[model samples]
Target: MLSPLGVSYLGLDDEGFAHFLRGTGAPFASVGALTFLFALLSLGRWGLRVMLSQKHPYEPWLWDHSWRHELQDQRLTQLLVSWPVSLVLLAVLAVVHWLFYSRVFSQGHVLPGALLGLVLLGFDIIIFTRVLGPTVLGTLALLRFGRMRLLLPGVPLELGSRCQVHLEARSLARMSNVKVELRRIREWAETTGCGDERLTQSVTHIEHSHTYTVDAAALHEGKALALPLELPEGGPEHSTALHASRSCHWELKLSSEVSSVHLDTTFVLPVYYVVGGHPARAS
Candidate 1:
């Protein structure tokens, strides 16, 4: 029996109503609701950051510039473009699993070892597809755009000196609006929260940036792209410690606006400060 509010039990004794409240909804009402609300708020903040960054391409601080020294390729952006196809494939896989594989697994006729092997095979296929898909796409990109590599000068780059960087590539006449950026990134690991639930998070921020645009037509028939960047004297110098908890480093980011295949990659740059004819020491 329900009361006028439709929640109060009219027929239940005090103890019975207490038990119903404890088992069904009290925990969610008192604790889970607040946790869910906070999660939604955090998600909203992240979404806002993404939208703002996409809207303003020139602004680097609007986006999270996480530092990674790995060589980046066109496949990273291509993967974003392939998301729709991946999602459709995932939906079809889910349907097939629900309609056939789940029922087949429920039947006791198959041996446990064989069933385990089949599951393992499915996982292997998924992993192979993920690895191969990116490689195939990246290979096609390499064929179309050709190869490009950064050519740094033999002399070391100082904190406050102007440096000349070169990009060796072919068919620059076809590419348009080639851009280069020298970004200084500072990252550190911070421990948050109390003992048992302590969470260690690495935080990164772009401290200084120098952007330059190259005119593709200015390049001679078979000449490389020359990038001249002036480093700031006031900015923090590169840290000497490799495994320090906090450190700053420089990176060279290159991009182009082409019709079919565009070049986008980042390279680690070594920038040091000289003090008394010696490199500055890190504390």
Candidate 2:
């Protein structure tokens, strides 16, 4: 005995109604699966772009350390990384969908599973787009607001050696009360607790700092005002070394009174020292 809205009202038997429904709606369900697949690939691409943003393949030095060559290399490698592996997860999802489809229609039940699959796919896409859209838009807005240039004697300043630093600034509008500074930072990570309870945390020490105030008149005249700094050797190479457990670093900072807002920019000084040799390599 068939029911109200389907084949039963028209006098078809239960098995014939089931066959008609499954065979007819199967095409639409397959299309939904394909849509979900496209959304998954798109979300993966965006995640790879964000994860690799911190990697600058064009760095003056260390450009090719572990395949930091093309942006796509990072994306492809991340796509293949273990744990929540994309292809594996996709295969698992496919298997689950097929099982649910068979269980629903083959067992003479059709009230929910097919529709739920489409709902789940749409929900995931909604969540992904919502999170990704704002983050990308805001980052682009910030980059649009400033143009910056910093000059350095070079990377890896020698211990107890004097080095010259130059910083130049230009803006679309007049900027005033500009200042520049060189700061030495010593940083390390410490692990506390034990076993499964263990946790790692960072430590930072402001070893020393020197500041230079720019003449307001120079900025107004508009010839790319140059601010210079002289730094003597502090010690140690950057923590970027693969074997390093601690890092010693320096930062060059710039701040200017722009309209009513203070604009600030900072650059890390990548200096290293050589034993019984020379100061940090020339910037």
Candidate 3:
């Protein structure tokens, strides 16, 4: 039947009937199919880009490895797997009717098939917006917030090497009894299995000055330190740095009574080299 969009006719032998279908059903089917295909192609392209990104592990069956990792959080895998199946089934039904049951086209089945395909297409769009859309946004947020800069002595440290850590806290006003603790990551291979090792200590008092030196070799082998600073009731502006052997997982927690507390922590590692039978900075 040819709707305003394309050609749709039950039989070419009947010119009048063919013309009518062409004017209505044909156009409607063509427009609907084009819209559906456009949406599918767009989604497919997006899926490809996500799959190829650095953070994503290459997995054809999954949209993105990060999404798969979060499957348990939002049941995204189930939806992604089922949506395509539904679309494919509806498309196959339409194709079969067009090839073998041309008479059904005039009998009104074509319109329903086209409508169903459009509906499925709409559903896919909604799924993208409600499911993948938010997931992508959240991933971006995590990337921005969870970013850590591992500074070395004018260079980058290898995965297994030991280096000094410079921990700093920024803007610590309106907080009391504030304490900072550094916990080394135990589960990751880089963290030398020392679970939650305590590496240093700092107190957010008026002076706001404290420092500790730790063996990076021991820290990398899984040893970490927890540095807790007690902030005053009114709290003072504060920042601190520490020298540690390896980079470890760290977290910040403010006291419940403390309000409007701001903290910025950074880890700085120093580089070492072997020169003239002694270890020295690369520079």
Top candidate by TM-score:
1
lDDT (Cα, tens digit) per residue for candidate 3, span 27-64: 45755786798799978877765556434222212221
Give candidate 3 regions above 4 Å deviation: 1-115, 118-136, 139-150, 164-283
Judged by whole-model lDDT over C-alpha atoms, candidate 1 comes out at 0.58
Query: Residue 212 of model 3: what lDDT?
Result: 38
Among the numbered candidates, top lDDT falls to 1
Quantify how close model 1 is to the true structure by its C-alpha RMSD in Å.
16.9
Regions of candidate 2 where Cα sits further than 4 Å from its true position: 1-145, 153-163, 235-243, 274-283
Please, what are the lDDT tens digits per residue for candidate 1 over residues 1-283? 3233222212333444344444445434535565677699979877876686577533322233322322334444555546544554454444444433343344432454355447756965884498546555566566665666666663335677887777666666667667888888888998899989999998988888889887765443667677787877742235322334677667788887566665676766656565654445433
In candidate 3, clashing pairs total 48
In model 1, how large is the Cα lDDT of residue 271?
63
